[model samples]
Target: MDKNIIVSWMEAGMIQVPNLLMQKYKQIGLDEKELTLLLQILSFIETGNEFPTPEQLAERMTISSGECSGVLRKLVQMQFLSIEEGVSEDGIRFEKYSMSPLWIRLADELKFEKKQSDLKLTLLEEHDLYSLFEQEFGRPLSPMECENLAMWLDEDGQDPVIIKAALREAVLAGKLSFRYIDRILFNWKKNGVKTLEQARMQGIQFRQKTKQPTQPTTGTSSKTIPFYNWLEP
Candidate 1:
């Protein structure tokens, strides 16, 4: 063998296989020949061979064309692949194969996992929020207060950050009560302050409005106007 030919062969191109597919094939009960056929299909996709016929696939493997066709039928029956007709680049209609079932299954699994993870996180957040309220109140939360918190998280659709902001506002106002916090949250919802940043901005605007001094109704003159003289009486 020519040394240059050997070097070129050694530097063969690569194809990427998703780890999910590799990890899931056994679960799908694919046998050795079926797995090899799956790999060959993947290779076809990598090399821009969108629709490899049974004969073409058999040429690349030890299987006969009839056997390759049987395997293709079995794969389609198992929902591992699908075949559709499409116009090729030369305007000739041909069969187009798709392996979307695998991706669809993977996507559903990922969504389920994400939902589970989010549920766990929400439970943790609920516990932490309860702890925070108890710490601020210097006592354990009453069952009513706990129910209110649950309602805020689940039914009221309040963000945890907004809830915390409401609590901080109540603490600053020296109210330190669930009713006060709930009132703050209600006001925030009315004002469309769903995020922490929006809550802070709303707080600043409220403070500015309250901080502005009321304009004097009386004239600048030291002599009090008769209209304002009722102040002395």
Candidate 2:
């Protein structure tokens, strides 16, 4: 072992482990004895001691050598630590433990946490979408309306932003019905408008294309425009 390397590590700050590791200790399948063993191993590594015997480990704790050996064996079988036989500086064959498997387990735990967090965020956004609809409509949502909204989120996998944009378009068109909003969402989906920006840009393009110079009408009586004509297939 290099004395310079040990001196450099001492010059560095305190050894810090992630708080999540302690928080999720039980979730990672660590019993009290196993956790204690792991901490002891970590301490041994920190002090530049590679291999501590079961007797040496047991003496530091309240457990016996046999109990310590049993726990260590269990940890090895669970792949939390791997034992490898190596020659020490004293020319004696000793067992060396590697903590790579524990790191791998922590990595898996972090991935699971991220996936769960993402799922929670998506559900929150879906709930927000429902609330937005109720606020805009100025009434409690009907059961059928709630069902349709669930289908749009769960079955159709429509984004909340796209649905909100479609609702705004329906409001602009003076046709504030669920069917009209659904049709708008359908059309936007068909046109590959997956985001609010894409829908807004598409709306701008459509308005530009339809905008024309107003012509003077000859008849004195105004024509009654059909409201349900927009719903025609």
What Cα-based lDDT does every candidate model obtain?
Answer: 0.79, 0.81
lDDT of candidate 1 at residue 128, scale 0 to 100: 85
Q: In candidate 1, which residue ranges exceed 4 Å CA deviation?
A: 1-14, 19-36, 47-78, 88-93, 216-233
> What overall lDDT, based on C-alpha atoms, would model 2 receive against the true structure?
0.81
TM-score of every model versus the real structure: 0.70, 0.67
Residue-by-residue lDDT tens digits, candidate 2, 10-30: 775354566766887788899
Per-residue lDDT of candidate 1, residues 1-233 (tens digit): 89999888766656777897777676665677887887788778777787898999999899999999999999888878888788868999987778787577666667877899999988888788889999999999989999999899899998887888888877766778887788778888877887899988877666566555555656653432221110121
**Evaluated with lDDT, which candidate comes out highest?**
2
TM-score of 1: 0.70
